[model samples]
Target: MKHIRNFCIIAHIDHGKSTLADRLLEHTKTIGERDMMNQVLDDMDLEREKGITIKSHAIQINYPYKGEEYTLNLIDTPGHVDFSYEVSRALAACEGALLLVDASQGIQAQTISNLYLALDNDLEIIPVINKIDMDGAMIPEVTDQIIDLIGCKQEDILLASGKSGIGIEAILAAIVERIPAPKGDENGQLQALIFDSVFNSFRGIIIYYRILNGSIKKGDKIQFASTGQEYFADEIGVLKLTMTPKPEVKCGDVGYLITGIKVAKEVKVGDTITLANNPAPMIKGFEEVKPMVFAGIFPVNTDDFAELRDCMEKLQLNDASLTFELETSQALGFGFRCGFLGLLHMEIIQERLEREFNQTVITTVPNVSFIAYTSKGDKIIVNNPAEMPDPTKLDRIEEPFIKAQIITLPDYIGNIMTLCLGKRGILINQSYLTTTRVELTFEMPLTEIVFDFYDKLKSQTRGYASFDYSPIGYREADIIKMDILLNGDKVDALSALIHRSRAQDFGRKLCEKLKELVPRQQFQIVIQAAIGAKILARENISAMRKDVTAKCYGGDISRKRKLLEKQKEGKKRMRQIGNVEVPQEAFLAVLKLD
Candidate 1:
């Protein structure tokens, strides 16, 4: 136990965290040269395609230093804000963290956020500068930034290039020397902290845990402190690239336990595991993750509802942050109101459903929860636009707010401020990190930036700015629910929440966009945007005209007029009686408007 070192790698996205992990595996000879691959820890296909880490992975390596063998356990964590909960859990299971910063990019938004998380956990941080081989590398400037940020000596910051394997031996030596070994009571009652879990079709729920107080072995009966569920441990093992079975897992060791539980929901992350016979006190667990965005997910085919539900259940077992409930829409039919951490999380879930389960799905517009006070002295929280109460029945409406932090070059300050103000953002504070870069803070409505804010920011700054935000308390706002009407009938799927001041402009843009997306029909289609009984904007798509005059070769002018009048009357009746079928693309077109 004295020779065991447990640590994790933390960094912003695309900062060479995974590459560093690969190099460490090579330096320790845990994985052979032929088996070496880029981002071997990132196992998900979507993660590889998007070039981001979506899941946290843990591995054990054996390193020998000066005739003394040391056991090193490294946990690779996701850098995106959506997976911050996973990062926190990984941090809780470790004694130290390797903070990787890009030598050229310096510190980014996520880098600052993750560094604060490590600090909160009270873990020893080993600052390492990566990508030194790049031509644009600014090692000296980044070293000074690290010194100012963490108050560490300039020499303490290790320089390495993950791609070229530079300083690989030095990083491993630092981990063995600087990171403290895990301390636990081997003779105490059995207690362990489950940091992650995965469901296997053959083995049931495989729990990844860190032993804190005692030991666990095959045939030992274990109990969960949170759920009070007991199960017999069928197998115990450590992961060496893959699970390798062992007879026992001692205190301060990281490994997995096969609980023989078939259901995924039976096991949970952040739960304490202890012996059923003589259980010890439970360890402190992290707070539950709250979702930031909510949307409705319905199957394109109504018969696939059961399959969709089953797929979601399996996914929820691996992802604790995902939340969903049964919901029905008159326009969309039966589906789930799903809650996600952010847009990326939502997109990944949808993609998995389609690719893994072969079930096509339709997702409604994403929205934030709003608190509505009713005239009858009742408070209601709504996440879907259709669930909103009638305009007259509400006393007041409060929308979720977020505190946004944007870091960028000083030259782009004017463009960023203009974009922020256009989204109804209130400038709270501003500061300078250096003479060339600025940090701007704003308090804005969550709904304003939930969709196009990041894209627009990237476009304005030419991809130089980094942004991060967190939810604050709700604030009162002059918000109104706007509806889209096709052929004089309101479509529930196209309703949106907008401020009164921008309602006219928003409605006009939506109407114009919808007109282009909706297919032409035999009769004229009238697209209208309305707020309650008042119509804000309307667009007319004329009917496909057939030449009534073409048929009359040499008719009198009066006869032609009569024929045209009859044709006009016939078209009017058809418009009133005909039903307009709005396609799926029309409903989703409103999301793409600027």
Candidate 2:
């Protein structure tokens, strides 16, 4: 067996993890002059556009050091907290981690969280401070913080600039000397854990597995430890850090296992790939992640619903991180309730689904928590407008909250404080990085941050802020289940709960934002913003001035009269209790507003 060092590069979002990987690929001569691709591990176009890592990817390169060749299996993982579950899975496939800390920014909340996870895995960590080429770099201070906070040896932390190729050779030397080789039972049964897989149109399901023990080659039968289904290995190959048609991989190797499989339901992440005739005990440390945020996704054009469904299913084949179910709303005809790891993950998934599937969609406001209301003997899972109960019928409603950690420069601290206070934020504590940057922790309701909160924060900070959050304990705050009534009936798609003090303002803002989003109604549409007993604001939509004027009841006068009668009847069905002609878009618009 070859000397293999399997490791993953982990850091906070945009700390140069991808850039470091790119530098390594170039430094080790893994890419040729003709290859000409930048940030090769960021293979997906969608990932680059968003400036975030959405998936866990890997590559292999052979580096020569001290007259010897060492095989480096480099795994790249998402740094965002939403995708932390995937990060754990990726960590399971590696023996060590290269923790990248930005020289200018120093340690962050995400960096601490990621470091804690690595420690739990018992993985050897090699700290490397990156971005040394930038102005105001502080390599020694960050190195001191790593040693003081993490209690690691001072010499173990390497300093480098991933962007300028500075200290890259030293990083390679540290990897060869500090990180250990892979170890497993050489004589045990042929067992492996399938961390990730991909289904190509031509090659079928290309399963990626790390061999735990024993060995198998072409013609050997393998059984899925989870499903007990068996298949023959038609082909086996390693993802060449640098070429197509990857080389064949064997035991103690991290590579792709092609079984000539065509079924999507058969292969799953976290499944076990073992010999068909013999099996071993399952690995001890795998955990299923529960989604923390959700939203409703629907095709802009109803005709494309089927296409959207197919694309979602196809995307789910590779990304087991996403969750969805068939859902419907009075405002939206039919759609799927999609679950995501976090806000960024939710946006990335939506963007990829649209671009890859060629489908345009209308997405609801992303929700951070699913409130459950139990009043009297009734039980309700309040997620949408229809599920929201009347205020009088409710006894108590439970909402989810989050523990948010923000890292930012000192200049915008006052603005962030004001914005958080407006969202009913409670201060937790504060820490500082030297004297310039501060780590401010806050206990904010998840619902407040899911909406325009992110955009608002970015605007206030001039894009200098970074955020990470996790679920905190639930709290009982003043909650009101507000319902939106179109005319006289309730609209499920436009239902939400707001604090008593903000109910009127929330309603008014929602109505206004809706007016801006939705087009004019065919008939004179009336938009009224109302609280329980009083109307706060009202707008008069002009009547359908030009529509139906041309060829009015021309040929087939009876049919024309019938149509006009139907239109009038439709108008009557609309509630005119307060001289308001509520259009369909009004409900949709309200749903998207706050």
Candidate 3:
């Protein structure tokens, strides 16, 4: 127990967390030089392509410090705000954390957020300043920032460059000396916490856990505290780049467990595992994760519903945060209403479905849950805009709100304030981190930021501003559902809930954009935006016309007039009978509008 060290790396996106993990692995010789790859822990292709971490990965490493062998269980976590829940779970399973900050970029929004998460878990933190090899590195300033943020001594902070393998040995020594070894009773009843799980076609569910007390062997019967399902432990091993089977995993050790249970849903993250016959008390678990964004995902072909569902089920085994339910749409046909942690989460899931499962899916715009109160004093919560009650029947409507924190340079503070205020954001407070950097806090509607707020902020600040947000509950506001009508027919997928004050401008812009995107047909198309019976904006797409007089060659003037009049009547009839066929691009146009 004294030689075991369990810790995780936490930092903001692109803050050298992955780079440092690679250096650590190399220094420990866990992966030979021939087998090492860039961002080894980021196993997903999407993660490498986007230069971000989506899932947390765990690995064990052996290091020799001052002639003493130490076993280090290192868990690498995602730094994005969307995966905060995953980070929290990883922190709970560890005894210490390495909080890395970029020397060039200094402290960021996620850096502060992750630090707080570690502090809340009561884990010892070792602050490290990375990226010191860069030309723009500001070591002294960042060291001061860390001192101010966490009140740690300046000498305690380690400065190193992950790109050049500087100070790697010192970091290893610090881990063994600073981080306390795992403490548990070896003879106590068996207890373990499941931090992650994956499905194997041949072996069933493979669970990743850390034993809190007692020992688990290959033949022992184990049960899940949450599900109350029992199964024989078919295999037990440690993850060292690969699964290496062992006879037993003793207390204070981290490893994987394979149960004969074939059902993927039986194993869950954050669940407790213990001996079946002499079960111990369940350990304290983390809070259940609730999704913040909801969107409807439908297969491009209706025949692929079962395939899509199967794909979702398999993916859910790896990602416990993902949620979905069967739903039918008149415009989109049969699909699932899915809930996600954020826009990034929704994008990752969609990308995985298409790339890994080879299934084509169409996703509606993401929305936050809304509360609707009817005149009869009936309360309802709506996740989809199509399910919203009639305007005449509802008395009041409330939308989810968020408390957003923005960190940027003082030079761009004015531009950020203007953007937030434009989105119906109420300024809560503003403070200065330094003479040149500032932090701004605001209370804003979740719907306003779900679409293009981040993009607009990046554009305005020149990619210097960092943002983080959390739900602040619901607030009553003046909002209305704006519907898009194509040739007098409402398109349910194109409807959205927008603030009343900006409805006219939004509606006019949407109608104009749709007119440019919708393909021209044989008959004229009238695109209208209405808030109930009143049409706020309209645009006319002229029909494609053919020259009726082209066939006339040296005809009488009376005959030409008759042909033109007959063509006019035919066009009017076609316009009345024509149905506007809105392309998929038209439904997606509203999402691109500013």
Candidate 4:
């Protein structure tokens, strides 16, 4: 009989998944009491800084129950919707899940979505009501709410405070009793699904998976069904809370297989790892992620370009979801065009690359997908505003839309509704949550909500707003391609698609931002906004005065030539706007108050 129970902890953002994982780790004695951090599962500095789980990490702990050791393989999943795909893959690796519901917040949209996914997987569902230590964590009421939402028997609910470590043992015991054990052919060919993986400077790749059947030791050859790559298992091990690996992990348990595979591509998430002698078919839906948001990332200093790319590559090795392509803009020097799951995902990547990679980077304004339908029946995908077709040549244009769900105190519903309406959003429905918070749904353009929307939402509701959204579809609207002209010349790098009514407002804002961002040039530079032939807004950047004093004439001639050459080189570094290659500060200056 298998002496292991594999399960994952699922919850919405900040509902205490990592904290619970820490408590479990401590309970299992996986680490010494003195060494425990507040959130040990958040191994990345970025994850801790944001107080959000970005990647899925797992650790195994052995608990002594009834005089027998029970191996508890705990997988921690990101609760943010941007990493929803990772959450789905994480669910696949476990035979069961412990749904963490915030006692005060009750059931959220993400809670429902994750629970639905858990049910579809046919994994035994174990609901754990967390946050019981909070003042608002009314356990009984939350329990009733969860039972009503899931339509499950009340007996299935496990009320526990993962924060206080209260009832944690009961929760662990329930996993052993209620959750089903992994069922696979122990005598058949070896098969395991690759749910997640991480890279260690020491160990090339740690591929996490669940063995479907059959067991082999070190020196056994294995093949990834997805990549069709074969390699000898350098070692097989279980991950403990100490974040160290044990020698040998067995069948029916969640663990990592260390092969010579140095990159993430070799061990694709959702792929099957099996014996080379007998290979199984690859699981579908394990393809590399397609980025929804794209932006140019450049180092604060030009010399850091090579370092930036190398850091990005190393980070990508650990996270396959991050995508990058080389790109250089006249405004921004050598930089990379990066793709992300969403706005938050994009920011997180940039922050992490800087923090972990030890490099500072400047980022360009993000652009969204806009579909152009021309009179000639030509279809185009415009990720950059610069690539947008002439407004006159287009028959019609549609922007991607999302169905947003906002949960907030009832008093702020009116403010939220007004804010959405002003952004061309349409109210779909409104409902009540326990007569205190209201659930409001809206169909809004993805573009409007991509930037500054979260900040605005929090500000409007005094931070009472909590919500999630997914792509609904595309809707036709009166959208115009707004162009930012610098010195009366169109800057292809600074184009945007804005609603016709908001064009002038955004144009003026863009020009103002550019003036502040662009450094004082040797020659006075003018920033302008034009729609085709008409200029909507303009700003003038004054000429910069020579600051160096030359005491020598003949001697300084050589130095002056060098100075002029340096000036020319600096001009060359700037992206060409019309006929001029501007300076680096021109790109950095445009998006700020300074």
Candidate 5:
């Protein structure tokens, strides 16, 4: 165990984390040149295409230090705030973390937040300033920032360029020398923490766990402590680029287990696994994930509902942060109310369902969960606007609030403050990190930032501002349920709960967007955004007329007028009878109402 060093690399998005991991893997000779590629740990096509790491990956490598063979387990984690849960799970299985910060960008919001997470887990921190090869790299300034943030000495900060492969040897040496070896009793009771898991159709569920005590081998009877289900360990292995099967894995080692359990819902990430015959006490696992955004996910075809559920189960296994429950909408029929960490997380999950699982789905308008108190003193959790109680019956609504932190340059601070203030942000604190760098804090509603605030912040600050937020609690708000109606009928899937102050502008923009996207029919479609019985905004999509006057040519004016009148009557009848289904794009267009 003294030779085993388990650690993870964490940073803000686009801080060269994956790039650094590639260099480390190359220097350690864990992966061969033929099998190597950029962002090798980010194997998913979506991740590669987006130039981001959406999932946390684990790999084992051997590093020779002082002529002694040392085993190192490296977990490469996603840097986005939406995927912070991934970092948390990876941290739980490690004894140390590589706190990678960008030299050009200095320490950003996620860099600090992920640092706190590592500190909370009692993991040793190795601060490495990456991307020092960049032209704009500020090595000295970033070093001071790191020192001030972590209270570490000047020499403790390592300077490395992931792009040019500089300081790779020093980083490896630091991993071996600074990071402590995992401690566990190989002869103690069997106790392991299941940090992550994935589903394989042919092999059942494959789980990645770090053994805290004792050992496990093939054919051992293992039980999930939470579920109390026992299964035979069909395969035990250590993780390589591809899994390498082994006879057994000992304490303080991170490895994978294949139990041949076909059901995806049966296995839970963060669940403790122990020998069923000689069970160990449950290990403290992760806290339940509180999702920041909620939306509806329905199959394009109702018959595929069961298959989508199965796909969601497998997805939830891989992503423990995603939460879902069966929900039925008046307009969309059967679907699941899915909770996600943020909009990006929701988008990735929706895309993964389509690409990976071959499930075609329709995503509705995303909204934050709300707590509604009724006149009868009953509290209701409203995840869907369609679930909101009647106006007369509801006493008040409480919405989630978050304390947001933004670190940016002095030049963009004014624009950022204006943008955030427009979102109803309240100024809490402001300070300067250096002569040119500033950090601003605000208390704002979580719903305000759920949609376009991030995009606006990036655009306003020219992508220089880094933002991070944590939910504070619920606060009373004058929120109303806004319903969209097409041709006088409500579309429940297009309903949303919004603040009363911004409801009119939001409704107007939504109606305009829908008008631009909805197809024209034989009759005019009246699109209305309404709150309760009052219509807040409206738009009309003109009918695709046949031009009855074109055929009337040179006839008497009365005759032409008579023809037009009859046509108008027919159109009015058609409008009364014609039923409209809200376009799928219209639902998603609400996300871009910038």
Candidate 6:
């Protein structure tokens, strides 16, 4: 057990986390020169395209130090704020973490956020400065920032360039000399913490776990603590570049267990796996995920609802952070109200459903969850706008607020302040981190930043600003549920709860955006944005004019008038019975009203 060192790498997005992992893999000789590729840990196509880690990856490598071989387990974690849940779980399964910071970008928002997560888990921190090969790299500045953030000595921080393979030997030596070996009772009953899982069409669910105590041999009967269902362990193996079957995986080691869990609900991510006969107590350290964004996803064809459900269930096994429940919309038919970590997480899931499962889905407008109090003092949670209570029966609505942290250059601080204030944000505090860097804090509603706030911030700062946020709590607010009515028919899918002060301007933009997207029909279509019974904004698409009057060139004025009146009557009837076919793009346009 003294020879085994388990650690993970945590940093902000694009802070050279994956690049450093690749270098480490090469230094340890885990893969051959010809077989090695960039971002070998990031196997998903979506992840490769986006250049981000969407899932946590774990691999074991053998290293030689001081004439002795040591087994090192490395868990590479995602750095995006949306995928922070993955980072937390990865940090929990390790004894130490490499807090990687970018030399060019310095310590950003996620660097501090992930650092706190590591601190909470009581893990040994090894600070490392990466990307030192860049032309704009500020090694001394980043080292000072790291010192200020973690309070580590100057020599304690390691400086390395992931791209140039500098300081790889030193990093390897630090892990073996500094990080302690995993400690557990090897002779006790089997207790393994399941940190991650993946679904295989041919082999069922493949669970990735780290043994907390005891050992598990191949073909042992195992039981999951959460489900209480027992199954024979069909395969037990350690994770290399590929799955290598081993006869036994003992305590203080990380490996995969295959029990042929074909059902999605049968396997839980954080559940404990123990021997069915001499089961160990369940590990209750992991917390239930609190999703930050809410959206509705429905199948394009209503008949594909069952297939969509199957796809969602399988997807959830891979992404445990996603939460969903059955939902119905008058306009969208049967769908699921999905809770996502953020907008990017929601988009990734939608794309994965289509690209991986071949399931085409429509996503409704994204919003943050709200709490409502009824006139009778009943509390209701409103995730969808349709779930909002009647105006007369409602006491007040409380929306979720978040404490946002923005780290940017001093030049763009003014613009950043304006952007936050425009979204109903209150300035909490501001401080200067360095001569060039300034940090600002604000308190704002979660709903205000759900759309294009990130995009706007990036553009305003010229990609120099880094932002992070956490939910503070709910607060009372004057908000209303606004709905879009087409020809007096309410579209439940287009409804949203908005702040009362900005409703009129937002409604006008939405109505105009919808007008440009919805296709024209024979009859005129009226798009009305309404709050309760009062309409706030309206846009009209005129009916396609026909040549009915062109055929009466020689007719009298009275005959032309008669034909026109008859045409008007027919158009009116069409408007009553004809259904408006809202295209898929129209639903997406609601998210890009700006």
Stronger candidate by TM-score (1 vs 6)? 6
Top candidate on lDDT is 6
Candidate 1 structure quality by residue, lDDT tens digits, 1-594 = 989999999998889999999989988889988888889898888878888888899999999998999999999999888788789989999999999999999888888898999999889999999999999999988888789889999879999999999999999889988988888899999889999887778888788999999899899999999889989899999988989999999999999999778776677788899999997777985778888888889888798888888788878877778899999987778999999988878888888778767878888878788998899979999888787898788999999999999989998999999999999999999998867668899999988887778889999999989988888999999988899898888887788887788899989999999888888877899999999999999998889878887777785898889888988898889989987876778756766779
Instruction: Give one clash count per candidate, in the order shown.
Output: 0, 3, 0, 5, 0, 0
**lDDT of candidate 6 over 1-594, digit per residue (tens):** 889989999999999999999999999999889979999999999999999999999999999999999999999999999999999889879999999999989989999999999999989999999988889999999888988989989999998989999998999899888888999999999999999999999999999999989999999999988888999999999999899999999899999988888999898888999999998899878988999999999999999999999999999999999999999999999999999999889999999998999999999999998999999999999999988999999999999999999999999998999999999999999999988889999999999999989999999999999999999999999989999999989999999899999899989999999999899999999999999999999999989968678878885799899989999999999998998898999899989888
Identify the superior model by TM-score, candidate 3 or candidate 6. 6
Clashing pairs in 3: none
Residues 348-410, candidate 3: write the lDDT tens digits. 999999988898888876788899999999999988878789888999999999999999999
Tens-digit lDDT track of model 5 for 310-384: 999999999999999999988778999999999899999999998999998989888899999999999999988
Best by TM-score: 6
Better of 2 and 3 by lDDT: 3
Ordering by lDDT: 6, 5, 3, 1, 4, 2
Stretches of candidate 3 above 4 Å error? 260-262, 553-579
Which portions of model 4 miss their true places by more than 4 Å? 242-248, 263-265, 285-290, 299-307, 544-594
Query: Where is the poorest 10-residue window by lDDT in model 5?
Result: 579-588
- Candidate 1: clashing pairs of residues: none
TM-score of 6: 0.99
Candidate 5 residue pairs in clash (backbone atoms < 3 Å): none
| Model 2 worst lDDT run, 10 consecutive residues | 574-583
Q: What global local distance difference test value does model 1 have?
A: 0.88
Estimated TM-score for each candidate: 0.95, 0.87, 0.95, 0.88, 0.97, 0.99
Give lDDT per model, in order: 0.88, 0.76, 0.89, 0.77, 0.92, 0.93
Compared with the true structure, what per-residue lDDT tens digits does model 4 show for residues 380-498? 87776666787778988888898999888899988998889988898999988667767899998888876767778989999778768878777887878777766666665677677
User: What's model 5's TM-score?
Assistant: 0.97
Query: What root-mean-square deviation over C-alphas does model 1 reach?
Result: 2.1
Report the lDDT of model 2 for residue 141: 86
